[model samples]
Target: MRGDGARAWLDEGLKLLAEQGAPAVTLERLCERMGMSKGAFYHHFGSMPKFRTRLLAHFEAEYTTAIIDAVEGAGGLTARERLERVVAEAVKDTGPGLEIAMRAWAKQDPEAAAVQERVDATRIGYLRGLCEEAGHATPSRMATLLYLALIGGAHLMPPLPPAEMREMYGVLLPLLD
Candidate 1:
């Protein structure tokens, strides 16, 4: 009841970004989608730039940091096990539209670019650590390959389905061994 209005804006705005890309996340479009008003948007975010920053932050936290935390914080898990957890999270998250859109936005917006760079570095670093822990000889290369596969899958026209993604990633399991 309290922050529900702002939360609605965030959730709906995320959907808009995923389905329609960052350009489609304007105040007019988000309000149109939510059947709300500028007053309400301002009530929650105070300004569009503030809202965009919040939206990007939410995406990074939810899609990146949260997954990393879940996998790494699970305790007693091996490097391969941590990767398996990431795969599982991939299937359960909101698919790849947001990922693709964020990456594309990074090409045009400095703020998004900064966030994207951090995310890329953080993820690849995480994967490299996992590979090293698993005794992979070329951890950085292996990690980059793994990350590239995930991003490539996002760029697919219809986007790859979750089961297919899992299967695709499964093919790399042998490399870990």
Candidate 2:
């Protein structure tokens, strides 16, 4: 009976996804984690396909769109500041587990792959924009490096911490000067 709401289900799903990857996100496991049942899940999502669709959408909006919106909406910052904010906001978002899970899922699920692709493009595009604004001679290159460093950090055996990642960004960011 706990976690009856749709948001609850999606939130739980994201947690499961982050902890266990795509294959581990079965209704049984999800319900077990939520202390609920399949009926509650079906009541909210209607079908597995529908649920997956909604879940992917939710991840994109929460983990990607939200970060971009926040940074873009922040007023009066210089481009370098915006770039720094992008790193800070992304680190604050801290989706390493979910990021790895979604990427692994994307390898098998075309739907996930498409969403991942769009998400990547949008994230990188934002970085590139910020870099361009910062007057870098090679904005795209700088942007890609920044984006890749974050992605690479996520894949490390221990997974870099936010503090360390920010420190790393501090080092790389000066290249833009």
Top lDDT prediction, candidate number? 2
lDDT of 2 by residue, 1-177 (tens): 367688888988899899989999888898888998788889999988899999999999988898888887998889998888889987764558999999999999999999999999999998999899899999999999999999999999898998889999999999999
Per-model lDDT = 0.86, 0.90
Model 1, residue 132: displacement in angstroms? 0.7
Error of 1 at 97 (Å): 1.1
What TM-score, computed on C-alpha atoms, does each candidate reach? Answer: 0.91, 0.94
Per-residue lDDT of model 1, residues 49-166, tens digit only: 9999998888788778988998878999988999888877876657888888898999999999999999999999998999999999999999999889888887888788888888
Candidate 2, overall lDDT?
A: 0.90
Model 2: how far residue 134 lies from native, Å? 0.8
The clash count for each model shown is 0, 0
Identify the runs in model 2 with alpha carbons over 4 angstroms from their true place.
93-95
